[model samples]
Target: MALAETILRAVHKHDLVPKLTRALPWISLLFSFASVIWLLMLPIDGNYRKSYISENALMPGQVTSYFRESEWNIVRGYRNELKIFEGAAIDERNAVVEGWLKDIGLKTAYHRLHDPSVQDNMYAILHAARGDDTEAMVLSVPWTTSDGEYNLGGASLAVALARYFNRMSIWSKNIIIVFSEDGHKSLRSWVEAYHTSLDTTAGSIEAAIVLEYGGDSDYFEYYEMHYEGLNGQLPNLDLLNTANLVSYHENIHISIQQTEGEKLTRNDYLTRLKTFLKGIVSLTLAGIVTPSNGCESFSGWQIQAFTIKVKGTSGGNDITQIGRVVDETFRSVNNLLEKFHQSFFFYLMLGPRYFVSIGTYLPSAALIAASFALSSLSCMLNSGFTIPHFLLNISSVLKFFVMIELSSFLLSTFLPYLVKQTTDESDKISLVNLILLSMTSLVNINSKFAFSMISFSLFFIAMVIVALLILNFSLALCIGLLAMPLQFVQQLLNSIEAKIKVFLCLFVSNPFFVVYITGGLYLEAFGYQNGTLNLMTGLLTSWDDVQCWTWFIVMLGWFPAWLSIAISCGLGDFKNQAPVSYIKKNQ
Candidate 1:
C-alpha cells in the first residue's frame, strides 16, 4: 500500500511521458514507412525462399506417366462431341456428359439443384480397383465458367481421364468425376450436397483438381494455377508445390494470378515486383470478390484444391503434356498416407517456384496495425486516459455514431438487391457510386466527439486488421494503408490546404472507388473485358449462397467506421483547444 501510494503521488505530481507522448506521431510515421519498405523488399532475391515439397510420402514427378499419345484421340473425340451442345439447355448438356460417363463402365449419377438457375450436376465414380473405398479424390470440370465460357477442353480432358483411370489398377482412393453447370456456384452446391444431402458418397474427399482450359487440341503457352479458396483460404502449400514441380518435370511453364509477363522468369526486379503485387492483390481479394476459378468450391471440406488452366497459343506444349501433368500429380497425391499436412497453409508465392512465407510478409501488416494502436493510445492519453471518457457528451456521440452506422447498414442491406434490378454493366457500378456519394455529408463536429471517436475507431481498425492478418494479409495491409492518415486527420484540420488534403484522402480511400479503380486495373492487366458488375455479382452471390461476411464487414463495419471518422475530421473545430484543456485540468 505504501509503494502504491508513492507511485500514484509521483504520477500526479509529475508528467514523466509527455515527451514520449508527443513523439507518437513521428514514431507512427517511421513505423509505417518501415513497414512499406519491408513489403517492397520482398521482390529482392534474399527476402523469399524457394518452395519445396513438405510431405515426403508423396514424391511428385518420380513416376513415369503413360498419358501421352494414346489418349489424344479420345480427348479430341469428346471435344468434338461437346460442340453440338455449345448453347444447348443445361439438362441436354448434362445428359450428354452423363452418357459418356456411363459408357466408360463407371457408376454415374444425376444431381439437379432445385433452384431457378435450372443448372444440374453430372458425376461418375471410378471405384479404386486395388483398395477399399475409404477415401476419394475429385476431378471436377465445370460446364461453363462463371463468366459464361464453356470449358470444352477441360471437359474433354476430364472424360478422357475417366476412361484412362478405368484402365489402370494402381489407384487407392476412389476417383469421382464431376461436371457442373455453373463453374463456381453449381460446383459449390454440388460439393455441399455430395457431403450432406446425397446418399451416395465415395467417402471422405482427400483432394480435388479442377481443369479449366477452354480449347482442347490447341497448343498452350503456360499453365495458370489458381490456389485461392473461398474466404481467402489457401490449399496446403505441398499440394501447390507438388503441381508446380510436376509441371517443371514435364517442361511446362506455370504462373498464378496477375503475374503474366515473361513466364517462369523471376530474375528481374520489375518481374518480381509485379508478380508480388499481382499475387498480393489476388490473394487479398480471394473468395468474396476475386473471380472464381472453380477450385475454391472444395475449400472448408478438408480437401486441398486448385484450378489448372492452360493459356496462350505460342508454346509447343499440347494437351498431351497437360494430361501427363495431371496424371503424375494424381499419382503423387494418391500416395498420401493421410490427408494433407505438415505444409504451409498461409503463404505468398512470388511465382510457382519462389514464395514469401507468412513470417516474412506478416510483419509488414502487424507494424501498420501497431501504428494505429499506438496512435489510438496517444489520443486516449491526450484526453487524460479516461476509460469511457465521461467528459464526452454521451448522448450526442451516441447519436452521431449510430446515425452514421445506420446509413451504412441500410446500404449494405439493399444495395446488392438493388443492383440486381438493373442489367446495365455501367449502371451497376454507377448505382453504388451514386449512393455512396449521396451518403457523404460535410458537417461540423464536436472536438470531444472527434477525439473520442478517432480514439475508438483507430483502435477498432487496428483490431480488425489484426484479425484480418490471420485470415487475409493483403486485406489487412490494404485497409491499414488506406486509413494511415486518419489518425492525424483531426490535428491538421486548422488550415484550408490541410482540409483539402483530408478530403483527397477520403476520396481515394472510399471503398467503392477503390473497387472501381482496382477492378479496372485488374481487368486491363489481363485482356479481360472491363466489367465491375462481375465483382458485384460475385459479392452478392457469395453473401447469399456461401454466407460470406466480407460484404457485411465492408458495409456495416468498414464504411461506417471510415465515414464517421471523415465526418468528424472534415468539419471539426480544432482552433479552439479550450474544451480539451479544460477536461485535462479538471480530470
Candidate 2:
C-alpha cells in the first residue's frame, strides 16, 4: 500500500503531461523524418528479400507447353474474324463473340451491367473432365482499355487458349474465359454476378489472369504486371511469383509499374535512392493508377487476380510465347488441390524480384499516427485533475462529437441529392458541392479550445489510422504525415496571434491546398507536365470504378478532422492564455 501510494504521489508531483506536451513536437518531427529514411532504405540489399513461391503445390513452369507454332495461325484467324465486328453495334459484337465461344465447344453466356455506364460482358466455361464443379480458374481480357483502344490481340489469344484447353484432358479445374467490355466496369459486374446467387452455375474461383494486349504488334518487348487491388488490397504474392517463374522459363522479360529490366547496384547510393523513390511513389499511388485494370475487379470478391499487359514494339516474345506462359501458369494452378494460402498477402514490391513485407513498412505509419494520440493525451492530462469535473467534461465531449458526426453524415448524404436536383452537368456537381460544403464548415466556428473536441478528433484519427492500415498502409501513413502538423497548429491557436493562426490553420490543414502543393512538388521533382491533374483524374476514376478508398479517406476522414480543428482555431478567442493556466483558472 505504501509503495503504491508513493508511486501515485511521484506521478502527481512530476506532472508527466507538461513534459510530454513540451517534447511532443520534437517526437513527431523525429518520427516523421525517421519514417522517410526507413522507406528510402527499403530497396537496398539486405533490407529486402527476393520473392519466392510459398505454395509447395505450385510447381510453376513444370508443364511442357504444347501451344505450338500452329496457334499463331489460329490467332490470325480470330483476329480476321474480329475485323468484321469492328464498327458493329453492341448486340452484334456480343453475338459474334458468343458464336465463336460456342464453336470452341464451351458453354457461353452474356451479362448486362449498368452503373455509371452500360456494358455487355461475355464469358465461357470449360468444365473439367476429371473432377466435379468444385473449383475454377479465370482467364479474362478486356474488350477495350480505359483509353478506348480495343484489345484485339488479347481477345484473339484468349479465344485460341480456350480452344486449346478444351482438348486437354489433364485438367482438374474448370476454366472460365471472360471477354469484358469497358475494362474494369465489365469485369466488376461479371465477378459480382458470378459470386452472388444470381449466377448459381459460377463455381468457386481459384485464381484469375487478365490479359491486356495494347496493340497488334508482331511481338512484345516485355510484359508489365499490375497486381494492386481495390482499396489497396493485393492478391497473394504467390500469384505474382508464379507468373514471374513462368515468364522466366519462357525467356520473356517481366516488368512492374512499367519499369524495364534495370539491374540494382547495392553500393551505388544514387541508383538505390532513385529506385527507392520510384517504389515509394508507386506504392503511394497504387490505389489510384495501378489497380485500374481488369484483374482488380476480382479482388473485392477475394479471388486472387492480376493483369499482364504486353508492352514494347520489337525484339521480344511473341503472342504464341505469351500464350505458352499463360498455359503453363494454368497448368500449375491446375496442380493445386487447394486454394492459395502459403504466400504473403501484404507486401510492397520494389522490383520484379525484391520486396518489403508488412513488418518492415508498417512502423512508418504507426509512429506518425502515434504522434496525434500523444498530443491528444497531453491535452486531456493538462486539463487539471478534478475527477468528477473531468469525467463530466469527457461525457459532454462525447455527446458533442456524436452530434457533429451525425450532422456531417446527414450533410454528405443529402448534398448529392440537392446537387442532382439543381444541375444537369454531372461533372460540375462535385466541385460545386465541395465549395458549398466548405462554406458550410466556415459557419458558426467554435471559439473555445475544449479538451473534448481535441480528444474526439484524436479518437477519430486513431480509428482512421487503424482501419486504413488494414486496407492500405501507404495511404494511412501519408494522411498521418499530412495531419501531424495540425496538432502543433492547434496549440498555437491558444496564443494571441489570431492572424498568423488563421493563415497557418487554413493553408496547412486545407486538403485542396495540400494536394495542390504536393502535386506541384511532384511535377517539379519528376519534370512531368499535367501530372497533378492526371493523378487526380486517376484517383477519381479508381473510386468510381474499382472502389479505391484513397479519395473517400481524404474527403470523409482526414478532411472532416482537419476542418474541425481549423474552424476551432479560426474562430476561437483564446488570448495569451496558456493551456496549463486555463485549466487552473477553470479549476
Candidate 3:
C-alpha cells in the first residue's frame, strides 16, 4: 500500500494540466479550420449513405392499398364540385366543404382565423371503431397552396379518402380530413385551436399527410416530399423512408426538393453536393425564409407531418399514384404501436434515398462553437482560472453585449412596423444598416481592456450560436464559421499589410452586405434570383407573414459578434494594455 501510494504520488508529480491549458488556444484555432473541412466533406458522395428503415416495425408498403378506381370517381366528382366554388368567398367555400363532409357521414368542424391572414377551414374526423379514441392521423388539403397553385385535385382526393376511410373498420386510430385556405396560415390556427379548444379536438394527432397537388392530373413531371417544418424541425426519418418506400412500391418516382431521385451516377457528384447544400439552406431558413406547406402547422406538436406535391406541367404520370402513396404510408403509420423513436429526427438529405444523419454533421458546428469555450477557458487560465475574477473582468463586456442586443431588439421590433409605412422595406433596412454602422463606430472607440471584452464576447456569442444551432443549423453554423476568424484576425490587426485584408473581411461580412451581397450570392448559387432585391423582399415577407427571426438573428446574433470582432481589430495592439496577468508561483 505504501509502494502504491508512492507510485501514485510519482504519477501526480508529472502534471500535464499546464501543457493542456497552454495548448487550448491552438486547439481551439485548429478546431475552427477542422470544422470547415468537415462541413465540406458532407456533400461528397461517400460521406453520406443510402437511407434505409431503422424501425423494424415499420414495414412500408407491406399492406394492400385499396384507394383505386372506385374512390377515384368520387375524387373526380368532388373535384368538379370544388371547381364550382373557385371564385366564391372563403366562407362559402368552407361551407360547401363542410356540407360535403357531413354528407359523407363524418363529424365535421369549422375554424375561422381571427387575423384573417388566411381564410377559414373545414375538417372532418372519422373515429376508429376497432380501437380506443386516443390517437389520430390527419390528411390536410388546401384550397390554394401558399405556392399559389390551386390544389383542387388534392382537395378532392382528400374528401374521397375521408369517405373511403370512414367506411373501413380496420382503422385503429381516428382519421382527420382538413380543408384549409392558403395552406399554412389557416391550418396553423386550426391546429392551435384543435389542441386548445374542446370543439376542435379529434384525439391527439400522431401523424399527418398534406396533399398539395395542382394542375392537370393527366401527367406530372415528378412527386416531391415537402418535409421541412417550422424552425427547421423535421419529422422522423422513418416517416420519410416509409413514404418513399410506399411510393416506390406504387411505381411512383419520388423527387426530393432539390434533385430528382434518379440512380446515382459516377458524374452526379455535383448534383449530390448541390442537393446537400440546398438541404442545409432550407433547414437553416425553415421558419424564417422558406415558404411552408400545410404540414408545417403540425411542427412542435410531435405530430409528424409532411406534404406530398405531385408536381407537373405536362408529362406522363397519373395523380392516382399519390393517393396510393398516401394510403400505404398512413397504413404503415397506423400499425405503429407508439410514436416514432427509433430513427433520426434531424438529418440532411442528398436525394430521396440518401441522407446524412445528425451524428455525421453535428461535429462541424459543435467544433466551431466549442472553440470559443476553449478560447474563453484559455483566457481565464491566463488569469489563474478564478471564476469570480473572470466574471468580474467580463462584466462590462457582458453589459456591452446587452447594449448591442438592446439595439438589435429595437431594430427587429420597430423595423417591421416602420417598413409598413414605407413604399419599399429595403429603404428601412438600409436606414437600420446605417444606424448599426454608427453604433459600431461608437464601439470602436478604444476601451480600457478590449482583449478580455473580445474574449468574453466570443464566449457569449458561442453560447448563443450553440443554442441557435439546435434550432436552425444554417443560421448558427453561418455565424459560427464567420466568427471563427476573429481569434486570428485580432492578432493580424497590428500589421499594416493585414489591415486591407481585415477591412475586406469586415466589409463582406458586414450585416448589410451579408443580407444583400452574400444573400444574393447564395440565391444565385442555388439557382434562385441573381439579385439582392428578392432577398430583402423575402425578409420583409417573412417578418410580416410568420414573424420569422431572420432579422433578430442578424441583429442580435450575427451583427453583435461582427461588432466585437471589428472593435477588437480596430483597437490595434494588446501589448501596451495593462490587464491583470497570471504568474505561476515558485514551487
> What CA RMSD would you report for each candidate?
4.2, 4.3, 4.9
Q: Residue 264's C-alpha lDDT in candidate 3?
A: 27
For each candidate in turn, the TM-score is 0.88, 0.85, 0.83
What value of lDDT does candidate 1 attain over all alpha carbons? 0.76
lDDT value, candidate 2, whole model: 0.71
Candidate 1, position 417, lDDT: 73
> What tens digits encode model 3's per-residue C-alpha lDDT throughout 215-287?
5464576777778777668899999999988877776666676455353222366776777776776666555
| lDDT score for residue 408 of model 3 | 66
**lDDT of each model, Cα atoms only?**
0.76, 0.71, 0.72
Q: Which 10-residue window of candidate 3 scores lowest in summed lDDT?
A: 578-587
Poorly placed runs, candidate 2 (over 4 Å) = 1-20, 114-116, 197-200, 261-291, 378-392, 414-452, 494-498, 514-552, 579-587
**Over the stretch 1-587, how does candidate 2's per-residue lDDT look in tens digits?**
99999997886688754465556656656766776777777776788888999888989877789897888999888888886776776567768878988998999887766554556777888999986888899998887754356777888888899999999998899999887775565677688788773463547899999888866765878887877676667889998898888888888887665565454213244544565456455556654542256666887767888888887768657889889978988888889998888889898876666678899888777766776776665545543333354466666556655655665566454543443354565656677678757965665533333545665686578678877875788678777777766766545655565568656756775776766666667644544456666566555555555566666677678877776665555555555335563334342
Off by over 4 Å in 3: 1-29, 43-47, 261-268, 314-316, 373-393, 417-444, 469-471, 485-488, 524-554, 567-587
Q: lDDT tens digits, residues 260-303, model 1?
A: 65656556766777778777777656565534677877877888
Error of 2 at 557 (Å): 2.1
